[model samples]
Target: MPRILITGGCGFIGSSLASELLCLGYQVTVIDNLSRRGSELNLSRLLAMGAEFHKSDTCDPEALDKLNDSFSCLIECSAEPSVLSGAVGDGARSLLNVNLMGAVNSFEWARRRSVPVIFFSSSRVYPYDRLNACHYRETETRFEFVDGCSGVTQAGVSVSMPLDGVRSLYGASKLSAELILREYALQYGLPAIINRCGVVAGPWQMAREDQGVFTFWAARHYFRLPLQYIGFGGNGHQVRDLLHIQDLVDLVVRQVAALRDRPSDFRGDIYNAGGSIRSSLSLREATEICRRLTGHEVSTASRIEARPSDVIWYVTDNGPTGKVFGWEPKRSAEVVLQDIVAWIKDNASLLKEILV
Candidate 1:
């Protein structure tokens, strides 16, 4: 089996991928700064499971240079990841240093070592203004996107969605990284794959106000915490496609194999990935599911003032990726929610330390 290196591997997605790859008999090493909430716990899990760990921040290029080692592949999972991050003055530079510059170092390292790179971008790169402009019909339960919108596709928001407008600081950073990755692929012949993923939730997401919507929703309900619907007239009509981490890991395994055996055929281009239409859900719909799973209804407040960068509806069109990889997400919205419920119950004591 090929050895794998995952930067930011102690986070939810990276840790999950590392565990999966390790179980499949691959040697794995992870690097993390452990700066975020729940990272320490994630690190512990990875360490106990036999994944090697190194403490380093990607913001420092010198530190990254030290880890420019021989590995079959490098999965770039380090990013602020919050669409709401860097919206204010305090977070702007920090977000750029981590998301943009960190990515630069990752690309440079892969170029030097001739390692395959898998970059995790985000659907947040699509502008919120355009997403909101999509024509929609509102049922009593949720807001549904209609077909009048130019960029919108039947499967959901297509990869062809408008990019001429502002997509927030976080989006700009990720998109900037994607553009740079293209350069590395073309110039250095780096085996690169960019996955512009949507909301990925499952067992170990350190859900917060800025990211991890579904996991946070489930945790709030499980802990009897107060919840709020803050946008689109507070009807809880905002919808997004939800991808499970397991499905993403499944794809990564394939990408790694392609990069190792057939690097020339793997284009360093963008691939949009999410649960697609089959696994999308509205906030109201998610609330009902949580209620059923937790058997407890928590108080939820509704605010009409929408937050900056909040979109009404944004699901992914997996058509392009399906044509290439013949892969579609098998996890439904119900299974995604149910898994969170099970995780929360199983780790209620530890979660309360960080969540409550």
Candidate 2:
């Protein structure tokens, strides 16, 4: 088995991926700053499960320099990981340092070692304003994307989407990293794979807003916590596709296998790791599901003012992706919610302090 190195391995996705890889009998080593809530817990969990960990921050290039290992590839998952991250106060500069510059450091390390980079990018890179301006229709239950929108289909937003206009600071950072990574792949011949993923939800996710909207929604409902529909006429009609963490792990597992067995075919490229329409839901729909599963209505509030950084409707078109990875999310929207509810039930006491 090949050794795998994951930056930000204590994060929701990274930790989950590490867990899967460990189970598959891969030698997994992870580096994380342990800054995010529940990161320490994730680190501890990974450590107990036969994964190695080091306290490292991606913002510091020296941190990457000090680490030397014979690994198959570097999985760069470290980021600010929130769409609203830089919207207020001093978060803008911090977001850039952690997201953009941090990625620069990661690419440099990979370039020096001639190691491939498996980047966990974001769907937010597709320009915020363009997504908001996409042709959409508001159904009674939720907002839906309409067909014939340039760069979009009834299925969802495709990779061909234009990259014009303003985007959230978090999105800008991710997009900048993507462009730079592409250059590195071209100039340095780095084997790179960029997964511009959407909302990923499952157990052990600590985020309650912006990035992991599905997890946030599920946690709020499970705990009977206060819930607010903050945008899109306060109806919770704003939408995004939800990918299960395991589905993403399965995708990466195949990717790593491909990189090992078929290196020639692994020419650097980007793909959308999305849940697609099969596993998507609106806040209104989410509330009903959570209500049914958790048996809690929770306090609900509505806000008419929409966040400038937020979109009314967006879903990743996984059509082109399947041609490459032969992958599609098998979990349904309700099944995703059910898994979240189950995770919360199992760890309600510990999660309440972080989630509520």
Candidate 3:
């Protein structure tokens, strides 16, 4: 059995991945800080399924030291992506410390053990500097990328795009960590895979302003909470290709399994993991879906300014990932939405526990 360690195993993607691993009969070990509100519930769910749990932060050097040689694979999903870039140098330091430095620490520990490491990166690593420079077409209810080959296919953004001048602090930190992972694979021959995941939504997400917009909206609608649209045009038509957590786990497991069969160097390499054009949806569409599914009134207040470094239309192409890993997302947008709504409805009583 593969002894796997998930660095942020208590969080959204990490917890979902751990649950899948347990179902597949893998011996899973999780290390997490348990700082996030709902992470404890995620951890408890995994523990109920018989996974080994450790309460520790992956950013700590001593904690990394203790994790040495104890697992066959390491999944690094622990990082802060929500801290606003405008919060002075202190916020910048926190992003670097958790997102970049934490990756270095985890990679070093995995390198020492010669174990494969998978890094959960973000789509923000792209060139946000080019966002407002491009024009988008408002077809029907959603926006589409309107330049070059990306327009015709609606296949969404590919990995070949440039990353220069992406001034967003979150993007920069994630890109820096990606570079560190690549260098470790190149310089030290450490095995690593970088997965730039699209908008990840599932039951585990606690719906904060900085992450999990879909779940956030659903929660807000269910509870009649306030929502402010702070990005793009006053019309909440900014598009994103949201992916379900289950699809993400399938990709991670397949990539890790492939590496075990033919361990090769993947230095500085990256892949975009997402649902592609078919799964792309705008906030307008999301709100309507929420209203229809939950039978609740959805309200939106518009703001003049968008979030810093917010991409106008960030979806995945998935061509390279499909070609390389023989994987494609299996669920549709309606399927994901229906499932999430059903999950929320069925577990209404447990929402407090899930939200922690």
Candidate 3: tens digits of C-alpha lDDT, residues 143-247: 777774322245777777666655577777888888889988998887788998878787777657667778877877776666777767667888888798788
How well does candidate 2 score on lDDT at residue 139?
88
Considering only N, C-alpha and C atoms within 3 Å, which residue pairs clash in candidate 2?
none
Whole-structure CA lDDT of model 1: 0.88
Model 1 scores worst on lDDT over the 10 consecutive residues at 318-327
**Which residue runs of candidate 2 sit more than 4 Å off their true CA positions?**
none
Best by lDDT: 1
> Which digits, one per residue and each the tens of the lDDT, describe model 2 over residues 1-356?
88898999999999999999999999999999988988888988899999988898888889888887588888999988988888988888999999999989988998898888899888888877777776778889898887545788878878888888787888889989998998888887788888999888888788756667778888888777788899779988888788988899889988888777665565468898889987878988999998899898887799999976888887878866777787888888888889988988988888888876
Between prediction 1 and prediction 3, the one with superior lDDT is 1
Worst 10 residues of 2 by lDDT: 259-268
Instruction: Report the poorest 10 consecutive residues by lDDT, candidate 3.
Output: 148-157
State the displacement of the C-alpha of residue 141, model 3, in Å, after optimal TM-score superposition: 2.0
- lDDT (C-alpha, whole model) for all candidates: 0.88, 0.85, 0.79
The per-candidate count of clashes, in order, stands at 0, 0, 1
Per-residue C-alpha lDDT of model 1 across residues 1-356, encoded as one tens digit per residue:
77899999999999999999999999998989987799899999888889989899887878878864769999999888888789976999999999999999988888898888999999988988878877888998888888766668767877787788778999999999999999899888888999989889999888887689899999999998889998899989989989988888887887888788888776577888899999999999999999999998988899999988889988988758867766778999989999999999999999987655
For model 1, give the RMSD to the true fold.
1.1
